[model samples]
Target: MRTMMTRRQLLQSIGSGFGMMSFAGLEAASDPLAARQPHFPARAKHVIYLFLNGGPSQVDTFDPKPALTRFHGTSAPSGNLKTERKTGALLKSPFAFRRHGQSGLEFSEIFPKLGACADDLCVIRSMYTERPNHEPSLFMFNCGHVLPGHPSMGSWLTYGLGTFNRNLPGYVVLCPGVPVIGPQLWTSAYLPAIHQGTYLPNNESEPEKLIQHLRNRNLSAEEQRRQLDLLASLNRLHLEREGGDAQLEGRIQSMEVAYRMQSEAMDALDVSREPAAVRARYGDGDFARGCLIARRLVERGVRMVQVYYGNGQPWDNHDDIQIHRRLAATSDAPMAALLQDLKASGLLKETIVLIGGEFGRTPSVEVSGLVRVQNGRDHNNHGFSILMAGGGVKGGLAYGSTDEFGFKAVEKRTHPHDVHATILHLMGMDHTKLTYRHAGRDFRLTDVAGTVVRDIIA
Candidate 1:
């Protein structure tokens, strides 16, 4: 039988050639999720973002203002700062604060379990954002831009470093239901769509229900493989005709990932396989389940896992600030368990765990017509707090602070850009150098502003 030359082979034999150049990079382009080397010596290999959606009150959690407590029900000195709604006298945190562990890091009464892990947490009390509203701030926190059409930090990481396991997605998002901004929060935007986060609505306990259509009931693995091969050939031919299409290539890559996932994805997502004792430690609730799943994903070589606390900004406690205590109760145990579990498994040193919300709440009572209760706090974009643990960060350190009333970042003031830059730096990428050409210019997670806050790094 005579050997038939395919279009790829025909071009390869013609001079130094188009096929040689294009197909040489073909394998690399086809496997976009293949693991790659970091820009330098990376301190961390994985990141787990514990997104506490909406604004959690800093004064009620990590940042305690003695002045606010002292002058409770009195006008704040910094009350002149503009807020989204009208506010009244200073609302002192109802929850008391106390020092924990050798770090002496203070925590609110609601977070006893998390406070136990204080020695491992690096609290940033001076975190600020560009907006007081949820939508823009969420965009800023996740995508580095105050707009929706930008790749999230997780998307950027997966795009930059890829993943170790080709059987699973490089980036994963866990939420019981739709988050505030929905899928846009994790979109790849100008980046290849394959780099976008694989979202899992983790409402079900069973792995099959957790990830719908995870297994095909109609076809065997071998049969499915043959079908995919044929489909791939057709896609490649179409791709050649179109010259090149990033979106089309992305879909091809994503199809391969979905196929490979049939082998390992279910096992990775099933929390029931974990020991009964382990389940007890993580506790019961959507947030708890998400924390456990985050650990599992990172353990299995996923580049990044973003676990949102709940759906529709559950932490947006505009009516009653006491709701924070209830929310913290549900999240505290799981947060601590994740830290302890990572440390026990020796993954803590190479995995970064970031915990915080979009912004923080005002120290004064929210007395606006929009608010239902008289005791709630307004949104405060000027100041907030976030916690970082493991991944070569200096634990037990509070790097910055808000003023006496906890209204604004006063010292060592840090922005969302700074946090993004610092996270990239820890993962061995220079913030300024991590760029992707989109439209007519280059875009990055930190945009034009961001300095690696190296002091927090070990």
Candidate 2:
């Protein structure tokens, strides 16, 4: 009878396909967050995800459907597509779409500021997801699954490449308040706890107030260092006794990060240090501040930074679709400025700026009775739009298309898995090869499926 080989032994013996997965095993013994070599030449070193939580209406945003406008209040074609709630006759966009940039890319008037940077954007209009609900869609988009208990894209990136900055976390999530699934959206899950995203409540502009308990009032720096050293030593001894504990190791690493942050993090989070003209350009609002902070974090070598629009589903406009105008007013300038700022700083070539929501709103008017108003659209998982800029993505382009009625992705259909795969590709990691052994099986960010939308890459 053949003897059973250890997982590591098996992986080493058959090494042709494993590629970076084998390298990852060798690096696991070192500091978990230390920077490591990518599987290949990396186009982007950092990622900034502008998560417009809640389903935003794609027809009103990047995907302009003249058919919906022409057939306004008409019901003959396409019939009713089943979604989370009941919907009525097609509801044309209230806002007008105009061509912008040298490429003549179209954008809604609600985002006039973003329209200025239209040439930098690659809008994907044929994106789809499994569920229409906020919770599952958010989970699918952020964590690559419709269920909880999976490592987020940020977590996966950190696990694959570690981080450039050791003073701060490899992955940082800036949200004024908790979104739908809260920290679970950034959870490390089967990955090491240390790879989980560091949550920062970006409600305050002041660096000190932005991160509470950042500095210890009672202990001096030297004394705190001594205490931390003692604690780390104790933890290491306990770790040796326990064989291995990810949670304990995570706590140890977090303490080291916190100690180092006493200096580096303060300077990184302080946007006021930027020139007044620069700050004014981004405009005012929590999201604007968050965007500015995201640039700052990435500039300081943070591997991934996710800037959520606001607390909860700020874009989930069920009662009235007009709420989008209000939401866009808050985000447009900052988002545009971020793209421009990255470009001006020459970071755009090496940094990715992704602006999107989990899913999108329906094209037809919602009649679900859940809301008092009839103007809003229902949840739509069939088709949506997202903007990807920089990080080697083709600029001034719209890669795919939705149906004429803007009801579904009819051409070059893209999924969240595809987006994740493409992102990992840009960062010099193969989505299929970057695997982590978990629960007696190898797991990946793309789960069991994904195809890198290579056509979208520059």
Number of the top TM-score candidate: 1
lDDT to native, each model: 0.88, 0.88
- How high is the lDDT of residue 287 in model 2? 96
- Candidate 2: which pairs clash? none
Provide the lowest-lDDT 10-residue window in model 1. 1-10
What TM-score, computed on C-alpha atoms, does each candidate reach? 0.94, 0.93
Which pairs clash inside model 1? none
Show model 1 residue runs off by greater than 4 Å.
1-30
Model 2, global lDDT? 0.88
For model 2, the stretches where C-alpha displacement exceeds 4 angstroms are 1-29
